[model samples]
Target: MIAHSVDDPLYYLHNFRQVLLWVEQRYADLLDPHELAFMQAFAGLDAPAQALMVRMVMRKGELFRSDRLEYTEIGDTCSALQSLEALGWVREPEQLSLEQLFALLRKDELASGFAGLLSRPRAAKSDLLSQLQALAPAPRPLSEWFAQAPVRIVQWCLQPLCDRMRLLFFGNLYQDWSEFVLADLGLLRFEQVPFSPGSRALQQRSEVDLALALHQCAERLEQGERPGSIVQALAGWHSDNPWLARRHGRLLFALGQQCERLGEWDLALAVYAQSSHAQARIRQVRVLERSERWQQAHALAVQLAEAPANPLEVQALQRVLPRLVRKLGGPAQPRRRARPAPVIELELPREHAALGVEEAVRQHLAQAGGEVHYVENTLFNSLFGLLCWDAIFAPVPGAFFNPFQAAPQDLHDCDFQARRAAQFDACLGRLDDGTHHQAILDRYAAKQGLQSPFVFWPMLSDALLTQALACLPAAHLKHCFLRLLQDIRNNRAGMPDLIQFWPEQGLYRMVEVKGPGDRLQDNQLRWLEFCAEHGLPVAVCHVRWSEAA
Candidate 1:
């Protein structure tokens, strides 16, 4: 015989007395103390007796399935029934019933009535046949059960029978499973089952298995179908399967145009955003384009261009390449120049070019590894161009920015006009020192339509110098410097340059104010050389880089 051990609380109750008490409290009516004890004894009598013990217990209720017992053993059930009778507990209540038990409890005189009253009469062989026959022809369909019965009845019957009910409403509905019926039943919603020993144990096991299954599903998705399948999966599940939201979003993106064909535009748009692939973004742009929303499409396209390109996204873009080319003015033809490198003598669009002088100075400086000290509206370009070479060749060791600090008089005059001229003179003056003479000479030659030895260069070459030179004569340089200070004082333009140093890296320095790119007149070059010969490292620092969003 296998060793019997009580693993549960029920196992601890050794006597019929205690088992009967448990059953009484547990159910309406079933085991009596003496019958329970006899069953326990019968359990000890080897394999043959164990089968009898089980039947004795089954006599008390309608048997469904129970822990393993061989009901087929010959005469096993009979022996157990006889044991019950011998104990004077479960009697053959010949025609006796529930009414008799009630009557006796009310009377209290018929103690013997208690034993027999508790036992129900055995069913006749003919009655069993009738019951089986009745059930055979009337097999109930689930549809009728759901439609005819109250919703509450189904909810109560289903109620996630175990913690690991392995079912979701929507997912099941997609497959025409009864989960939809469960969800449709009006009732309180719950994220997890309420606390109960059986429920908790079952839930723990169920959740573990669910997590594993989802992981496997994810792996399968990577190996098999495209994202649409995942979306379809998510769309089917109920609230109980809350994990599908993100997966659904990805699928919506993958399904792409087919979804639009299916009239699932909203779902597609949502997936485009949620998906990991950049293709989704391109799809969004296409959707907007197809709708003829030009501005929105343009903005989205720009955003797409800014992002790092990926193959799928590239494919998406290629699909709409013709449309993009058409919208952006037809494939960007290169413009030919009448003159290769124009000189600074002509005053062409001075105001328009002048407006961007400060930006020009900043860009030149950034490329040259220098900083813009101050930009005014005069001779600043010459100074700026010279410093750009110095910075590119010999950059400073550290970073410092002091564009606004200036002498009181200079600070009072940095208005747009004042700054342009001042900057023009400052640029010319610094370059004349001959330290950057070779580069400056090359640059000046380039301005005179000479090509550089270097193969390629940015298109904005000489833009800073030419604009500044066009803004002035010496008189204007001085006038603008003074006016620049006034503008600074009045808050029209920013503050002026007060720093006096080699814009590159040196201890001794001098004040150098930048001027607008359009003010670099002829005399400004001579004045700049004179300043350069006198040991003042005066120059304008054209910037080439600045903060971006």
Candidate 2:
């Protein structure tokens, strides 16, 4: 748990110190000489200096005006910054681009700074920036831009080093210093998994570099860099680490997608062929088909059909293969149809339209029978999360690295369940012995609001919990849970929109509501089929709104 508090003036400083200590202890070997030196020098700084540094590091941009750096805790910011400057951690930038200067100065300041240079001084900030940019002035120091200005813009030179420390601490660049504050404030809570000594995400220094490289590549892609160029940059990059390897695959997959969108089918095919992402092969087949390579597409589709990776793959192949065979001049195979679910045709009044189709159906159903809740995917997932909390949070090496993780590092990996097969089996054993009810209820009561990948705390109330546990049969739950374990990432969603529970009769039925002109999605269809196969009560509720009487 986070020990820092908002009441403390130096709470941010304490959080920053905690990160430095954590990375220094766990990732000492991975740290470069510069990082080590920075950590050492940072520790030697006084509290005010440290607090000021933390403030700068946590802020959005590297450049900050000295006046804006004011803090009651860090009295006399300039005096504190002197120590940072001595260490070359923070310094006045040599030059600021037009954009940087524009960002630093407000509209009035910009007007004052370049009085005669501006055509329309009173114009909006954006227009003024455009007008200034048209002049194409060379980058210069802030003193040159605003000679009479009192405040100076100091750039945090050690931002990259600080970012590296943050990456090591969090195992990702996306999560930043705010996680500490959010956790401290109880806005976000993580499960307390006992991390092993060898639980760090990146075991080697090269892996750290690889993670950063992958992040940069992703950023480049997002910035609309050419897909080919980004792919070229990643040409020889590889990682033995499963996590890093997964990141690499995802990057390639994204590049492939971008290539497809740009009408570069050949490049997309090449990228997809090289990518290890689960969806890459199917994409490759699609690209082949699109490029009029029918034979190749057919062959690949056949291979996928024979050994599909997951149910989603199987579902996709069923659609692709028949078309491919037809294109290859083979007899068109009959499309396999999804099993039919019981249907509830609802012509609800327009008066209830504002409540949405699902809610309207839920209300109509409640009038006819028992309680109805618009749970969608939450109810069963929450149940599974509660029942199998122990297995999911097991402190396996490489599973957990930091205390801030909401789920394991490898939660969506293919071998996530395989890695904890024994633990999952034991958790499932409770269902067979009828102990699942007590176990789920106990976990719900004890672990309420604590983070779990599967649990949706806001959706699971006492009434819903008690009703679900009582009404949902143990055998049916075992089947659903097993299916969830089969492919957690895909199977967790696509559940029916609402579940109707009859507490008095110990009965329940799930309803997938579809408004007018809406059809069931592939995932929803898959779930409905699964329910039908296991003899679980589920129905498709198609709603059509009617005029009020």
Best by lDDT: 2
Error of 2 at 142 (Å): 4.8
TM-score of each: 0.21, 0.90
Model 2 clashing residue pairs (backbone)? none
Lowest lDDT 10-mer window, candidate 1? 397-406
Q: How many residue pairs clash (N, CA or C atoms closer than 3 angstroms) in each of the candidate models, in the order given?
A: 79, 0
Off by over 4 Å in 1: 1-248, 251-259, 263-267, 274-278, 327-329, 332-549
How much is 46 displaced in model 1, in angstroms?
Answer: 20
The whole-model lDDT of each prediction reads 0.35, 0.87
Per-residue alpha-carbon lDDT of model 2 for 1-549, expressed as tens digits?
A: 465778888888888888888788888888889888888888899998999999998999999988899998789888898988998888999999999988888888898778799999999999999999999999988778777865678999988788788878777788778776666655677788875556666888888888898998998999999999998898888777877887788889999999989989999999988888878988988999988999999898888888888888888889888888888788979988878998988887888889887888888999997989999999999999999999999987577767777888788877788889999999999999999999998998899889899999998888999999889999999999999988888899999999999999999999999998998888998998899889999999888888766
* Full-model lDDT, candidate 1: 0.35
**Runs in model 2 with CA error above 4 Å?**
1-3, 7-9, 106-151, 326-333, 461-463, 502-506
Q: TM-score: which candidate is best? A: 2
